[model samples]
Each structure stands twice: as C-alpha cells, then as structure tokens.
Target: MAKIVKPLSDQQLLRYSRHIMLPNMDIDGQEKLWNSKVLIIGVGGLGCAVAQYLACSGIGKLTLVDDDKVDKTNLQRQVLHTENNVGLNKCDSAKQSLQQLNSEITIDTHTIRLTGEVLLQTIQEHDVVVDCSDNLTTRNELNLLCFKTKTPLVSGAAIRMEGQVATFTMDKDQPCYQCISSMFGEQELTCSESGILSPVVGVIGSLQATETIKLLVQIGEVLSSRLLMFDAVTMSFNEFKLNQNLTCSVCSK
Candidate 1:
C-alpha cells in the first residue's frame, strides 16, 4: 500500500490532462491511480465497461480474470473484443485492446476460473476488486474473500432492461454483499437466459468505473454503503442505503 508514486511524465500529463485538472485528482491523485493495482473478475459486458474506463483513466495495473473466451453472441454488449478475436480468450482479448487504449499502463491476463486458493491471494494483492462476473457462486465467493482481506469491492449487474451497482468497503460497520444477497435471495440472470439490451450494461459499468475511481483516488462521494439501481425502460435511477447484518455469516464472525 505504500508503493512509491512517481512524478507524472510529460506524456502522462498530456494524456490525462483532464483528470489532472480536476480538484482532488490533481497530479497526486492521478499518480495514486497510476501506481495502484486493480483486480477485475469476469470479462463480460460489465467487465468490458469497467476495464475500458479504468484503462482510459490511467489506472497503473489492471489484472483481468476470466476463463471464458470471446463468443460471437457477446459482440453486441462486450465492446472490448472484436469480431476478429471471437475465438480468443476474453482476458487475452481484453488485454490486447486495453493495452492499445493506454500503452503507458500494464495489463495482465489470467485465463482460468477462480477458486478459493486463487481468489484469496489475488484479493490480497490488489488495492480494489471489481466483481463483474455473472454467477451467484462467484459473486458470493468473491464477496467473502474481499471481506476477509478488507479490500474494497465494486459490484455491478445488468440483465434485461435493469441494472444495479453497489460497493462494499469491507469495513466491519458496513454491509457485506452476503447481507444484501440474503435479503434478495439468489436468482442468476444470464444474458443468454433472459436477454439484455446493449447499452444497459454500459450505463451500469460506467457507474461502477466512476465509483472505483473515487475509491482509488480518495476523491468524491462514493457509493459505499449504498445501492444504486437503474431502469433503462423508465430512465429512472434510485438509491438505497445498505446496513450491516450482524448475523451475516461472513462479516459478523
């Protein structure tokens, strides 16, 4: 966590001039993000948006985890992969594109499905973890590992015309993802199962990126302890406060 943050290069100043101009994100904040490492799980729609923006925003190192490959069907929503890279692994495809987006940053790819052994150490290595995976099991597992490590987690999901974004600070006083999942119960919504609009994931993913930047740079009000829901059909956005469950299996004990 005490990694040295070097001074911005002339090209960095030129590339991220807009971010450097912002109040809290001056050279110091930009340098912080430029030196930070972020672990992103999944390379689907939500992952595409989150990774792309963070790349463009100049997050120093982005480690992407996904066992899946690029599918022809994913072309509609997964913006990072190209038709030419259809048969390629998603993490490999994302690394290629994201590196092109920002040559100054480093992009790492892991082409394996995460397990308990891999997830725990990975969460401990990164400053923040973004849960963009599609399954309930993975989300639940990532939440628990993140809580154990006390690393911040930003989660997003989009199916059909609706999406939601939430952040877990991994603070004892704040709610863990398990608390929310307990209330809502598990109901996996895969794009293949129910279908999804192209831009719906974009909206949600961009918000996730926004929250991540705030967390990384230590600026702006983040979505911590709050849930943000979006309805593309009605174009309405709603916010809900989240409370810790004292009986939560992961966080309570």
Candidate 2:
C-alpha cells in the first residue's frame, strides 16, 4: 500500500518543463513552488521583477502591496509600468502586467499602505514575505512582524549604484534584518535622493527572485544570517555574515 502522487497536468508540465528538468528542481520542486505563496511589499522595480519571475515560475499565489501610484519617472527603473500605466496604482499596474505573464497563478494586490493588523494578517497568510520596499520604516516593521509570525523574509534594496539583499528564516536563533540595519544606524534614503541605475535594480531584484525560489524549493544554501552587496560601479559582489545584535531590540533579548 503506497500513497498516491497526483501528476502535474499536461499544461503545467509543459509550462514548467524547464524547471522540471533541472537536476535539483525536477517535478517535486516544481510542485513545491506551485504550492507556495509569496507576499511582496512594494510593487515597484524590485517588486516588478520579483513578482514577474515568481509568477512565471508557477508559484501558487502572490500578494503585492503598494500605496503609491505610478509616476512617469518610475519608468526608468520600474520596468513593469509602461507609459499607459502611468497614474495607476503600482499594485494595480503590477497585477495587470503579472496577469499577462502567467494566468495560472493567483495575484492579489493591496493598493494601500500596509500597516497594523492588516499587515500582520497578510504576512501570516503567505509562506514567504519579500521586502522590496524603499523605506527603512517598512522594512523594520516587516522584519518584526515576520519574526512574530515565524515566516521567512527575503529583503532587497537598491539605491544609486549599490544594492543589497538578505534573508531571515525567522528562526529564534537566526539574526533578523534589524540586526544588520542597526549596524548601519538606519540611514534612510530613496532612489529619488540618490538615484539608481536602470538595470541595477533588475540585477538585484533578479537575485531576490532567485533567493525566493531557493527558499520555496528548499534548494541550495540560503542567505540566512548573511547580506549580499552588489556595486554596479565596480561590477563586483561582496558578502558579509550578519550576527545577532546582543543589545538590539528586535531578534534579540
């Protein structure tokens, strides 16, 4: 007496054939990705790439959050929003674009600033929370909430010619994002202030997507307790270990 394993449909098998053929991915990994739900905050540049890749990869569901409307200036880096999508809410614009990419996946958009109980419940609902957010306040808030819900977090940020990505498994023994931000003294900066290269975000956001897929499929070594930095100026990458801050408020006693 053996358990039954439902096979992927012809359409799914065809759609995800590339993934199913991978040595590590195969059918089981593709199935796990199909069953995973990922929450992405900030449907801007990073969000655009993250959601697009996740959707096309066959993730079961994706929830996007963003209160801001698309501005003409966003076209430079936020590649998802076209001239026609200008003035549309980012979440709406992103959903429309992502829907065009993959119809099998469910895409939910929250066209409002995510905060309070709503934020808590949203994170709790998803398996992974991706922070493509620009501001430090939101990132810190997400880190704390993700910790509370014991959900894994994949965080990314791009400003000027530099970008960074990190992950927190929300394990009690692991170092959370606040552990690293506190080390930087929480300096707040936006793309408008510092300016970002058009492709720089794509590079980082693609990495974020890569990290998310690895998290979902439980493949390879995750970036937990580590930060990856990329400098477009030098065209090089660097990595650093993030240790829990002993005196810090979050992820520490």
Candidate 3:
C-alpha cells in the first residue's frame, strides 16, 4: 500500500520555506520528505552527521540503531554526543540531540546490535536505509537485506584521510556493496586503527544524507551505480562507476 502524504501546515511551510523555495525541491518534494521514513545504522561519526541533517530537514521518522555507548574518543567526530553523554548508549544520546534539532520528527532508538531476522524486519519497514556501520560484515548483511527487499540504501565509510559514499537501489543493473567489496578483497582497516580525519566522516556522511533525501524526493541524480570518493589530505573528490556483478554472492539471486 502506498502511504498518503498529508497536507503541509502553515508552520511546516514556514519551517521548510528555504527548501520549498528551491526550484528542485518545492512544496511537493518537501512533503515527500515529511512523509518518508529512514533507518540509520550505527550512531557513530557518519551516523551522527547523517541523522543531524535529516532531522533538521524534517524526515518523518528516523530509527537509530547502535549497541555501543558514547566514549570519550567519539567526542572528536561524533558531534551528536557530548562529554556529558559519555557512557550513555549512543542511540539514546543521539535521540536527545536529534530531538533538540527537530522535535516534530519521530525518532526511534535501538540499543542492541541488529542481526538475523530482527535486522531484516527492521530494514523492511523503512523507505530507505543508511549504512553508517564500520565493518565489512555488517555492510554486506545490510546490502543483502536491502537488495532482497528492494530498499534504497545510502552507504558511507571513512578511514584515515579517505572516505567513500555510494547508493544501492538494488536495481537489476546496479551493484550491491558486496560486489564492490569483492573487488577489493577483505577489508582489514578500521578507523580506530587507521585514525580517520575528523572532517572526513562529516564530508562522506553529509553526502550520504544528500543521497537519501534525493532518493526519497525522487529528484536529482543519486549516487546509485556510482561511488564518490573523497581525499581530505589532497582535498579532492573523485567518482567511479560501479558495475553489477552477475555472480555476486549477495545480489545474484
């Protein structure tokens, strides 16, 4: 069943006036965003940035999943958490921040790590899924689930001074994360070990948020079938075409 979009109130029009004034995103596009639901995995650096922007932009519903707690180390890049939130569950802490940004939007928090059937069910409920998780395992799982369900996914990753963002719509000709990951073999680097630049995640995360909005509003060219890479050291942005793998273990079926 298709969800019916409610008429925007005067307050909503005023709140989103800037967006409504944009030629690409007028009232109709803003309404589409107001009726959309997005699930964000991992409330880390990338997740925090993505949630913050979406919340302010008025995404109807946001589900934040993360089992980890806020640590002192996260303060540098995870802007959604503060020193006072240290030791608190990341999801709860993020909820507090997002609510402060936009109390009108509904925010759901999940404190436990998502896996198995539970994860699949959660992904099935949302209009779009944003992958902010760090591990290849979790990324692969999300890609497979999103592919099976035909949900659009905005994926981002950052390590050291490099970052990348991609969108997977599970289109027949589009490649899933597994297809891209397979080309590079197994990933062994992590932000904790490699030390990511604070702004790198922000850059990639912001792009993921932009892609999610574009997908929901049905406007502009999304990152689908393409990968956008950023190098903070050299301050350069590059894009690469992503090809579907017919024998991809996750999306072939």
User: What's every prediction's RMSD, in angstroms?
Assistant: 1.2, 2.5, 1.0
lDDT per residue, candidate 3, 43-161, as tens digits?
99999999999999989999999999999999999999999999999999999999999999999989999998999999999999999998888988998889889999999999999
Q: Per-residue lDDT of 1-253 in model 2, one digit per residue for the tens?
A: 7633445688999999999999999999998888888999999889988888899999988999999999999999887899999999999998888888988888988988989898999998899999999888898999999989999999999989999999899887789988887756556777888888989899989999999999989999999989999999999999998888887688776
lDDT comparing candidate 1 with the true structure: 0.92
Candidate 1 per-residue lDDT, tens place, 57-151, comes to 99999999999999999999999999999999999999989988999888988899978977798889899999999988888899999988899
Off by over 4 Å in 2: 1-7
**How well does each candidate superpose onto the true structure, as a TM-score?**
0.97, 0.95, 0.97
State the lDDT at 32 in candidate 3.
92
The local lDDT score (0 to 100) that residue 62 gets in candidate 2 is 95
Best by lDDT: 3
Candidate 2 TM-score, true structure as reference: 0.95
Off-target runs (Cα >4 Å) in candidate 3 are: none
Decide which is better by lDDT, 1 or 2. 1
RMSD from true fold, candidate 3: 1.0
